[model samples]
Target: MTVTATKFTPEVMLSAPRRSPGVPNPSGKLVLYTIRVLDIESGNSELLTEDPEAGCPVWVGEEKVLYLKTDSRGNTTFIVRSVKSPEPESYDIGKINAPLSDLKVKKLPSGNIALACSALVNPDGELVNPETDKKPLSSAKVYTSLFVRHWDTWNSDRKRSIFYGALGEEDGKLVLLGNTLTNALGGTNLSSPVPPFGDSADFDIGPSGLVFVAKDPELDPATYTKTDLYFIPLKTFTEPQAPAPRIIKTPGLEGYSQTPVFSHCGTKVAFTRMHSRQYESDKTRLILVPDINNPDVTEEFYATEDGAGGWDSRPEAIAWGLDDSHLYVSAEFHGRRMLFQLPSTPSKATQFPKLIETPKGSVVGFSVLHRPGSETTVTTADILFVSSTSLIDNSCYSIAHPGTLECRLISSTSKEGKSFGLSRSQVDSIWFSGAGDYDVHAWVVRPSTFSKDSKKKYPLAMLIHGGPQGAWNDSWSTRWNPAVFAEQGYVVVCPNPTGSTGYGQDFEDAITGNWGGRPYQDLVRCFEWIEQNMPEVDTDRAVALGASYGGFMINWIQGQPLGRKFKALVCHDGVFSTLNQWATEELFFPIHDFEGTLYENRAAYEKWDPARFANEWATPELIIHSELDYRLPVTEGLAAFNVLQAKKVPSKLLVFPDENHWVLKPENSLVWHREVLGWINKYSGVEEEQKSN
Candidate 1:
């Protein structure tokens, strides 16, 4: 039976990943945005910039601020403003003659700027702006041997490169010095900041003016793509210069290494390093490469041997402590992204890193205000600013300091009291005995009309999360939102089953080569627990739905011995044939998860291949697939639909030609929500009750 959550459960929890398109800015007319600074000591805030497009502010000394301003015509210029003077001057750090599409700009320590952009340059170091180029994309002939097609974009010679130089005298003029870092060999075909997709954090410009960069290692096709660290001296970036990179060798790390960050003193570098060369799920260990007159000495910085002890220990953002002895590392744990303060060097006395108290939600991005010579720093104080969000709210900004109980909220995304006609759902935590008697945690969202004493029993919608390595956390989701089901008068159950993150290392690794084993049992037991114990649920009219790995589980569930537990099932972008998915985009994921190639481990592939057991399928199902979904090719979804149709199990196929793995478009998402809910309503008769009420 489907049961709604009680009132007492607690609530909890993308990074430099280009802010998802779904993120909402305030809905209004074009209002000019101004940069404002708040003083913590005096609780006073003053305007810093009045430019409408001023954003991505970076602190330049004590009283100077550097920010980017983009105009209506897509022209961008960096502005350096002073705060100490009565009339702060805005220094026009003019535009670089490069495509501003997905551009990134960082203020270097030496009063210069480093830009990463997609540009076409001549041998003479002049930018050939595509908008004004004689040959446009329609007329240009593009050729590439590797990564011809990435996540979405087609790669040609117009890949991204790093260019460092100062602004010229003209308002928007750029001075070109050295050649593009990624194009030194005529064309390295390498993406820097690390493409298909990457951010400023992927590379670092140290205080010493040397650029510590990370990119796919130039290797033959036989080897898996491995990212390594390289040193690019700023001095070499002169006229007629070639981009020279000195590779930093890590003896123990054979896997990919990115996110290279240098310490405040520039004597050490910290980056996430994985060990296994070919495994995608390999544990990333945070290591400190000390500058002891050698580029090869890399030592573990965190106390834990395997690092943070979850699905992936690789923290996305790492910041140094003002003292330079500790680092604030952010990683996903138990469905929530948490921040921990760990020492720079290993310590026998400290066994575990300390978790800094944060709002019980995801910490997306943060900036630290070191204030080196300030009064508080004179006595040693920790000061930080964070941007975070929860299920009920959009992102908000806050300030965390030494004296605060929690980070103090400085600004909120929502208006002070304006209601947006959005209703908050009641979500509660539930724990039940899963496979092997392990305690499995899941969340239940109650319909707005549900009451503990009410006689009305609601049908349940079991929502399985995608990442076999991911978890359903206490966070808001645009896709697979539990609130949507709740709004449709169905109680939603989201379980952090086996192999889900935030549990521990062992639990996450359990489903590695045994995909259809314990994780499926965890879902079965989670379903059974709700049916037997919860009196407010209509268990007999439940529908199971999943996407990605969760979608794989939905297919597996239809063939299980207790497959009759659910009335219907919906699988979106699921894997039907494990063997057939070998050609999927990420070769390393399935290779490592299934343990070797499909031929090498035929038994492993057959054990989890849902298509093999189609004869056992009896439940009515709906299959959804997108053409652009490279991770799980659209063929898997089509094959699953073919089986359901052949067996006459009553199925329908929903396909999106333009969308990728996710139904990200606004209209498509609306259709997805309606169709999936409509299928459940048709089978379970839940919509009739809503209409009658």
Candidate 2:
């Protein structure tokens, strides 16, 4: 078998089948999606019964999709869509966030009923857009997972008013503490009480009590950085007792680490190190340490991947099957991602994956949506993924390994013939060098309809990605507006330049202070490659558009000599200057520095400032960002806009109060897409340019 490296093209990746846990189901079968399922596998899927705005669907029995349906009037309601029955009935979970977290309606071994739930809360009355320099209010649409005591949800805080800058549930007694940002639990409910860290955390229940780790570093509620493990007793606090916290590790690892997992037997623990602190170039190391601190033989190796090859730390979503050998773990190795089940005991030199299931989108945290039965074997077991993407609805899939490729959406639907109507345009992976050995990864989505016989060329559009440490992957995007452009008459290019994650830590680290250096070269090289290889694309008519870190790229590009290569430039919530960004209070985490503060990196930051290049930016630009974009605040875009206006560069700005860093509403999303596409058409009307060429 030939293993081909991914082509840095966007066609296949953008349209690739993806699995996300947005459209949830009772079991991981019926998936509720916003778009109709297209080009799906034969007889494996059932088209959902409701509108595309519906979310979180579950199979009530075998024929129904349990989910929330949103109407055009901006009202969301819970309902059950049936496959065999062909009738849909409203099953209001009532004001609760649809697709309940760890949503389960199962009978216990002892036969008692259990129901759990969660949602984002904003008791602070915060109604401001997130400042790019400060920790944007955690209040903006963040979720907090919960476990409801009973079914009645009439008086819940989330139900009061689902209005603008709305507040989520603040009245429920959420049981599980699974990961950062929210409280999540696994297995049976814990007898131990929850901890108060101001931020979210996960837990493990043992014979002694409940054990969990607070990934935050500082004791200060605002600037927490260090992560530590602590044990909470079953007893509740009557008197004001200062809780005792025990440090699990002396150094406490580094960078951003969380999700301390307990071994199957409950005597040990496993967690991904993510990255090694700040600026440290190493892959996220997975280590297994024993529950007891024994002088001799306390810890042993379970399994681990080498190097900072862009692994997502805090992989708490791991599942260990009944038989120890059949261990399931999620990893982002081999450039793409797949679930690997390695044998517990190694007989041969290579203890390769025992049972494997690779999901379409990059698989993050995962768990057995349904564990194997008492008599189930390694070959005969059920595994569910929490992610699926065909561009519209993010849903889950039930992958029955060892059988026919049976991918059933927990909320999404699979039509009778083709699985889902959703089929991504073909994406091919390719790499190009920016400077020296430093290469960049990219995806190119070609125009839906193209002319091969005629020399007529199509317009090229550059789509930028955020997460200076995050990489743009082969996942279908509900908001990835570039696809619409491709469907029209435009060719789109997205590059995982130097600063992007997934390639390796150094690849990401290289961009820390050199954001405009190697990273910029990579984008330039991508443009040049498209010009040379994709002659069907018009070079001068090409435009650049991105948000956050990607938005920063556009700013830097406008300033560079390569700025002459692009015609129209669009900035979406991009960072304008490094100094202003650094000086502002970013969230509580002290990430601006690992060993020291930004005071230490003053010189490095100055060199990386994007504002310095504003004088050279002559490209006709469009600035579309929100007033409340905290990730890359409106100020950054404003700074660029100020420059463009002052220098008399053709520029415009589109600001929306309803949107934050990301625009989520359907109407808003459509508007955003239409605006971007319109800009491309308005400025880069390429028929004239191509004819001249």
State the C-alpha lDDT per candidate.
0.65, 0.50
Q: What ranges in model 1 sit over 4 Å off?
A: 1-93, 101-148, 153-158, 167-189, 210-225, 235-243, 303-314, 347-349, 371-380, 402-405, 414-425
* Weakest lDDT window of 10 consecutive positions for candidate 1: 21-30
Q: TM-score for every candidate vs. truth? A: 0.81, 0.68
Per-residue lDDT of candidate 2, residues 304-357 (tens digit): 345323233223245545443444566543234446664333332154444354
What RMSD does each model have against the real structure? 6.6, 10.3
Error of 1 at 657 (Å): 1.2
Model 2: ten consecutive residues of lowest lDDT: 158-167
Top candidate when judged by TM-score against the true structure: 1
lDDT tens readout by residue for model 1, 213-296: 454555532236567776655532332343556677766676767677777776678887777777545567776777723566
**Per-residue error at 25 for model 1, in Å?**
20
